[model samples]
Target: MTDTPTTLVTATGDSAGKTAITVALARLAADQDSSVGYMKPKGTRLQSNVGKTLDQDPMLAREVLGLDAEMHQMEPVVYSPTFVEGAIRGTEDSEALRNRIREEYDDIAADHDQVFVEGGGSWTTGGVVDLTDVDVAELLNANVVLVAEYGSPNDLDDVLAAADAFGDRLAGVVFNKVSDDAFESLDQDGIPFLESKGVTVFGALPYEKELAGVTVGELADELGAELLTDASTDAFVERFLVGAMGGDEALRYFRRARDAAVITGGDRADVQTAALD
Candidate 1:
């Protein structure tokens, strides 16, 4: 905690607009003409190019925050697999490792007025990874905002599970990528169902292209995404699809890329096939 007394923002429950929330919060806070700062406390799976491992996501905040801050400060750890699970699984005494992590957290917490810390992935999605988002939030002393991806009525259980995860520090959760019909159902059944569990619904954002779309200017502004093809800054984009579809017919889709910006998520087999080609 710095002398400024910053409020830490941690969102973990399915990637669920975590990055978007980070950007939007910064955008909204900046719009208010306030001096707020951003940080991702931790990171995973950094990309290396030309012997340089780059922290892409946090770079977006640096550009938006208008701060000359380096990526190292925004994202403290950039390595394979998230650090939480990594620490929990090892025989290396969780208490000692936890202390080290907290030390790293306090070091950055000492910097800004209000630091927005984005949590990694979901809290409950566990496999061999034992430590979850709850651990991260608890260690960091941050409040939790769970974003429910279950847009339909049948997903009430999902919402309940998230509330249960947040426990005492549960601030307010939002339902994202909601459909029109689903939103209707959510208004009646879903919202009441969530309310019954004592969780407040903040705001539900529809699945919009703008969230994913990157105008060349926005792309350039975003230090995370690189523009393969050069274009004017004034150019705007419609939608960005990660993982280009494989097959000749699918490639033909790109022929109509006038207003579309294809953003393929690599490591996806279909994307690797189509995007690599």
Candidate 2:
């Protein structure tokens, strides 16, 4: 595959599902009997294992995708609190980090037909260490795929800005989390506009409520709240409604939404019941 073809999956903003798409593509290639590797060069989410702080995403990729690369090689520069603090204090070694990432990526790429490199949370992430997603893509000479959640007109602007930034390196764009109405607008106006501007639209994935949702247990853990009810932890929450309004208004809003998690005060029995019902 042209000596390990590499693709960098980046995004315009957080929660754009960059990792999901990267893994999906990797799995697809692997299922087709192609050797696929995965890496996340600069990671923000750190996990502590026996006092060794490791990046979470690459570990996920390695375990889930059965990647052959070692954990250290898959995740080269973990943005730990101390690491970032040291960078801020001018004690961090930027060149050393770059060398480590380049060396690991070279080794990983050498062993596979293609490698999927997952970028940081956002395009501008890791600027403190001079290793933004764009910088990484340029460093590795990888084709870029920018993922953006298509909700508003500003999303189109962000994708266009990414196209401007990446120029010829940009392979295409994947629009995610587009609702029915937004998809209609994007198919009619946004895709045509981007095409007119010489941008490649690879795919526009419609918003799937089940796939885009967070489980109730996940939400509880995120908020540090105890789940008091015996409701199923696997229940997905695609929308969150937070307020105390009149019964009619609440009913109207509840009826409009599917798989919603309503958060209100303890005394707001009306909203609570409305949500539960």
Model 1 steric clash pairs: 242-263, 242-264, 243-264, 243-265
On residues 194-227, what C-alpha lDDT tens digit does candidate 1 reach at each position? 7777888887777765564566787677767565
Query: Residue by residue across 96-160, what tens digits does model 2's lDDT show?
Result: 88888999988888888889999987888888878988888888888999999887777788898
Give the Cα-based TM-score of candidate 1 against the true structure: 0.66
**Deviation in angstroms for 78 in model 2?**
0.8
Q: Score each candidate by Cα lDDT.
A: 0.61, 0.85
TM-score of each: 0.66, 0.77
Candidate 1 regions with alpha-carbon error over 4 angstroms: 1-15, 30-34, 48-52, 79-97, 125-131, 214-277
Q: Highest lDDT: give the candidate number.
A: 2
Lowest summed lDDT window (length 10), candidate 1: 123-132
